[model samples]
Target: MLKMMTFFQGLPGQQSLLGTLDPGLSEAESEASMSEASSEDLIPPLEAGVTPDGEQEGTSKKKKSKGLANMLSVFIKGKKKKDQPRSSETEVKSKARPELEGPPPTVEELKAALERGRLEAARPVLALERELEAAAAAGGTSDEELVRLQSKVEALYVLLRDQVLGVLRRPLDAAPERLRQALAVVAEQELEDRRAAAGTRAAALVDTLWRGGVEEVAAERLGARPAGVPAGLSEAESRFLHMGRTMKADLEAVVERLKPLFPAEFNVVHTYAQSYHQLFAAHLDTLAQFELCERDTYLLLLWVQNLYPNDILNSPKLAQELQGIRLGSLLPPKQIKLLEATFLSNEVANVKLLMNRALELESQRWAQDVAPQRLNGYCHCELAIDIIQIISQGQTKAENITSDMGMQIKQLLLVELASMLRSYQHIFDEFLEKSKLLKNYRANIIANINNCLSFRTSMEQQWQIPQDSPSHLMDPLKELKAHGFDTLLQSLFLDLKLLFKKFTQTRWAAPVETLEEIIATVGSRLPEFSELQNCFREELMEAVHLHLVKEYIIRLCKRRLVLKTAEQQQQLAKHIEANAEAIQSFCTQNGSTATWLHPALPTLAEIIRLQDPSAIKIEVATYATWYPDFSKGHVNAILAIKGNLSNSDVKSIRNILDINTGVQEASRSLFSLIKVV
Candidate 1:
């Protein structure tokens, strides 16, 4: 019981009741009394302190003392009624409200409560947003709530935008290193997005601005113009100039802005410039469709070309497209065709016609001057040179005009040159025929031949056509000149043959005057034959020498020297001396013929001077050794002229004949006819 009283004294608000408890009571009975008391009845009372109405400090203290006494009384009553049975009212009240009981909340439940608190805090903002959306969906209205909501939303938006911009802008200036790195990544992403968006917008804007500007300019330029009539740009020029200047400024601004971001990519600027150029091209095409005047079209094309300049045209990115947009392509098809015809086809045709006319005039002049009476004029046939010069001049003009046309003209000139050579050859042939009738026609013919050769030489030097020139165009000129030289050579030889035949037929007794005439006529002209003089003159002189020597031998054989009287022998010897002198004079006068004739002339003079048959036989044998044509007839004839020779003299002649003689049988018979002792 004492322990129970001590436990009761330790209980809060039960100390006052401890003194009232029966100390003599058993511990079990005291516990029963404490358990019987109601917990509310055991509660402490509130002390009235400061009241709303003004109250004295003593009254406040008395209220606090009365509250303390009431607290003590409740404590005593709760202790006194602890073992007593509860009243029916308290029991009924307890039954009416069952005691509430639950376990403590877990972490998840606490987290859920915190989330709910956050949601509850955001409810006002969400409600305001929903109201704003509803008002917007309802369309614009003067409703006060809607207006208030809109104003609120706008203000909220501005604040949010300022906050976002502030965050974005502040990092670069004030963020720490680590935060700055993160911001850089975000900034890079934003830049890429902006670039992509700008690319698309730029393309669309370029196209839109270009088309609008071009259309506006065109409308102003062509609105009142008549169909098929080109309009003057008095009014339109200003607009065009303005458009170009504006476009250039805009393009420069765009390039300057984009250059830093994409320094290596020309396409950024190329795309915009292409749009501007394409607009200009479209305008040009439209003007072309209206049958724009040549002058206007030219001026417009110039303007476009000048506006674009090499910087735009030669841009590595757009080179191919710019190459396609030349002045030629911008011109109308009809104009282009007309230009080609005028410069290329018509010019070539005109050159060919002029060449033909020049060639015809040259032919007529050649015909008029190449007459037989005007044989001296043959050397001065300026036809070929004149024709070549005219063609060359024409070629120069044509080349200045166009290279292709010049080439055609040059080819035609070559053909004409060949034709002129052929005509010259024809004139020469006619001249050759007429010349055959003249007494000294060979001289005239040689002069004409020399003139032709000289002209050909000059032509060769003047015109150095390449070997790779077209064969058909070049071959005729080459062949004709060569053929002309060959023909002239053949004609000269033919005339020579005729002159030699005439001399041979005269029995070599033709006067020195005749030989002199032949030499003067042909030899004087020899120097003019240029390179051909040596061979031609050598052969011709050889023929003359041979015929003259044969005739002299015959004349010597025919002479009858009667050596029975010294006076008669002297007369015959003098006759032989006169004939030998004539032969010597003829051979000496013509140097080309004298080479073989000179050695034989002295032998003939010796034979005549000795007047001995033995001397004749010795000389004749020596002459035969030199000239194999010397025959037995020559020996017999000379012996016959000597009359009867002494036996020793005849034997000496026969011994000379027997020395390995290989004469013909007919010539041997003449030897057999000789009577040798």
Candidate 2:
């Protein structure tokens, strides 16, 4: 059969189908060839017909060709029968032998094949790689072939790197399918590397392809200066602001678009998040090397320490996606501390400058004899408003940097606030003394009093400064408050002085007229009191009410109204009770929350009205209960006014009062204000 097949290959118009086919193919290649062979390979080439195009010259030639084909068929069939057992044995031996699969792709072929293309287009090259690797493993491929195969794979990955990174450089949402394809490539490469125990090669691809792509995107986005940069912002300030805006936008795109397309093992969200964070930190470190201004320093600190970590990284939508990511600070801790220190120093100086500027402006107004502005029918000044706003805003911004920074800021504000208060106090005193515009002066005094009240309340409530604890803050406030109140109410006090004098001169005879006149005088001032702020109005009213009660009792304590008769003492007690009720009604009606002072005058009247010694003793004990500051001297003074009690009776009453002493004192005391002579 072999001799006949070889002899046929040399004949004119005749060729053998098995002429060049190799029977000694390695087992693997033989199986591959067997599976891959087509029907054309099993059949002879078209008979050397009239022409290679399969055209016949004539019918005569076609008939002759038919006779020839019949003879060739008979011969081929006989040969196949004779070689059948030998062919079976050859196929069996080929299966049993281990053989090299094939030669790997040539360098030129791989280079041309691995040219940059879409990630999906690289599948053919990867298939070729698997075949070459199998050939090498079967122990039939030479070292040269193995090295060539290794080079092809390395070049293929290089192409993959370029294509994958190119996909990542575009916006995540621009071609989500393309991003998905690129990630799929990375996933396969990672799996291949893992099975081969090729450490970190897959990781390097992710770092160079995904992370490097992020750095490129971030740089491009951050370089875009936003429209209408505010006029006064430094270059650093504008850049920092733009960085925050762009970082958030890019990270959000990855989370919203790419996360769903990739699987969890890909760590798509964390990869994007960490890349953005590391790049951001590096950029901030560059910025921190310079001497930033106050605004820029604060903005830098805000982004690194607060805004990035809390508002951006932990935002509701992005937080869950980035939960697995451990992106660190936008700047190193030491750098952040330096920025904080610079910001706090600048803020401290800035606060002082603002407060001083506000004070200077107020001083100008005072020097120009400007009338204090009226707001909602009340005297108003911007001194407190401006200074408080300065400190409050400073403290708020400082806190945005850190809590410890905020406390330091508060301490700085306290010092500046104390100085401002002291300076304002002196300027106000000079203005009140020298300014000739009487109505404007009075309005300014009242406004300044309101200012002090407002300032103190803000320190205590908003700043949480303990009252009566920080003498520097509270003591200056106290002095300014007292002076302003005394100056504003000087006339009111003089009027009360005359009213009380008239009562003592009348010897308790015209109690109704004298006390009613006093009540009328205090009521007339309520409209002016109403002009003060609510906080100030209440405080002023309480002070006046306590002073009135103290003055009334002091007049009686003068011992001029000695009621020798029981009837006289009862009448006087009725007058005192009526006065106490009228005073309380007026004070309460005019917005006094000093409910503690309500019983001070009434209890004193009850002690005078009681006829029996034991009754009087019980009333004195009640007085002591209400006004724990009610002293032995107070009881003696009241008894002397009664004049019905002998020395022995007074001593017994005093003893009863002593027994009830040491009770809890009221928060605001009227008896403590009175000095019984």
Best by lDDT: 2
Residues 276-374 of candidate 1 have per-residue lDDT tens digits of 555655665665456544335434544543444533455444455345444223345575444433444443455456656755664454444443223
lDDT of each: 0.43, 0.67
RMSD of 1: 31.7
Candidate 2 — which residues are off by over 4 angstroms? 1-232, 252-275, 315-318, 402-437, 452-479, 520-530, 534-539, 561-571, 574-618, 628-660, 664-677
Task: Give the RMSD in angstroms, all C-alphas superposed, for model 2.
Answer: 14.5
Q: How many steric overlaps are in each model, in order?
A: 3, 0
TM-score of each: 0.31, 0.66
The Cα error of candidate 2 at residue 368, in Å, is: 3.1
593: Cα error in model 1, Å: 17
Poorest lDDT segment (10 consecutive residues) of candidate 1: 1-10
| Per-residue lDDT of model 2, residues 128-242, tens digit only | 4444433332223333333333333434444555566567666474577777787776666565445433325445545554555666676677667777577887777777677
